[model samples]
Target chain A: MPFFKITLIRSSIGLPKKTQGVLNALGLRKRMATVFKPVNPSTAGQIMKIKELVAVSEVEAAMTSAEMKALRKPDPGYYIETPGLG
Target chain B: MFGPFRATSPLSGGLLWKIPWRLSSPQKRRQRKRLRLVDNVVATVDAALKRQNMESGRNLVRWKEEMPTEEEMRPKDKYTMFDRKEKKYRKGIHKLPKWTRVSQRINPPGF
Candidate 1:
């Protein structure tokens, strides 16, 4: 099954109550928060409710929260060049 | 920012603080892009759901026919919203509160 990759692009601050509720329901508490939902009527309907607040894309696989976090983590400036001889 | 009427005193008046009535060119460009993005999302979801239904042998036609395709929507639906209080019973979409995050695509049938 495909998944809808949703990223909150716009802030929901001062928006209607229901709009805030929808974003929270989608697990988006801050801007740029990304969540993957299976493509179904329920998810589609939810997206419809907050369509303007997010950027949506369809992907074949859903990444775990940890994976998403890792993607955003910066790399260290240096890596261990030499380990003890085997 | 000045007062809404530029002068709070009852006897005093000047240029009123006015919100631009029309969207600027950049605003219009971004608005159209936003509209198109939403349309793209809807189409993606519809196509995926249709594929899922086909795989499951569930021939549900309601959702398939319900979502309006991008080309099927009129410019009025994309740009203006029906507002009884505004002149001509319509208003620029940017006039809507939280418009950047709110979808106001469909209007009343006769509007």
Candidate 2:
């Protein structure tokens, strides 16, 4: 199923309490926070409420938080080689 | 003072310790080869680290460029107030109607 990748791009500091609650329900605690939800009417409505504060994209698969972190991490390019003991 | 000439001790006066004879040619060659291999590994690791650093540095610069600035990141309603009691002009963002329909969802077209 397609997923909506919702990223909180702006703060909700002065927005209405209802809007803040919607953001909380969407699991967006701070700016740049990302959450994935199945593409559905309810999720779409929530995104619409905070459309000005977030960036949304459709993704094929929903990634876990750990996977997202790993994607952002830099690769370690080298491996150690050990001598064989005879 | 002297027992049978102890091969273990280089201090024994009668027999001189020969440097070249002790480690045979094959063992010396193997040690030299191992040292060269170690040097090559070190060079490879150094090069890899340099490349990684350069890539990371470029990524950092790009990230800075791509990230939204402070002005752009501020909440849309930051300058506006919800209350009408104040005399000053307040641009209320939440005063707008809540979106209930999926068709009302607004996002960048290409994102």
| Top lDDT prediction, candidate number | 1
lDDT of 2 by residue, A1-86 (tens): 66778888768887689989999999999999999887655565566566556766667799999999999988789888899897
Q: Kindly list the per-residue Cα lDDT of model 2 for residues B51-109, writing each as its tens digit.
A: 43422233223423553332343333222233345354343332334311111111133
lDDT string, candidate 1, B1-111, tens digits:
385767455436665656677788888778778777877766666677777873311222433355454466686666678999988998888888878766666667787
Worst 10 residues of 1 chain B by lDDT: B54-63
RMSD to the native, candidate 1?
4.7
Report the poorest 10 consecutive residues by lDDT, candidate 2 chain A: A39-48
Q: Which portions of model 1 show Cα errors greater than 4 Å?
A: A73-79, A83-86, B1-15, B54-77
Candidate 1 residue B26 C-alpha distance from true site, Å: 1.1
Model 2's CAPRI class is incorrect
Clashing pairs in 1: none
Model 1 reaches what TM-score against the true structure? 0.73
Worst 10 residues of 1 chain A by lDDT: A44-53
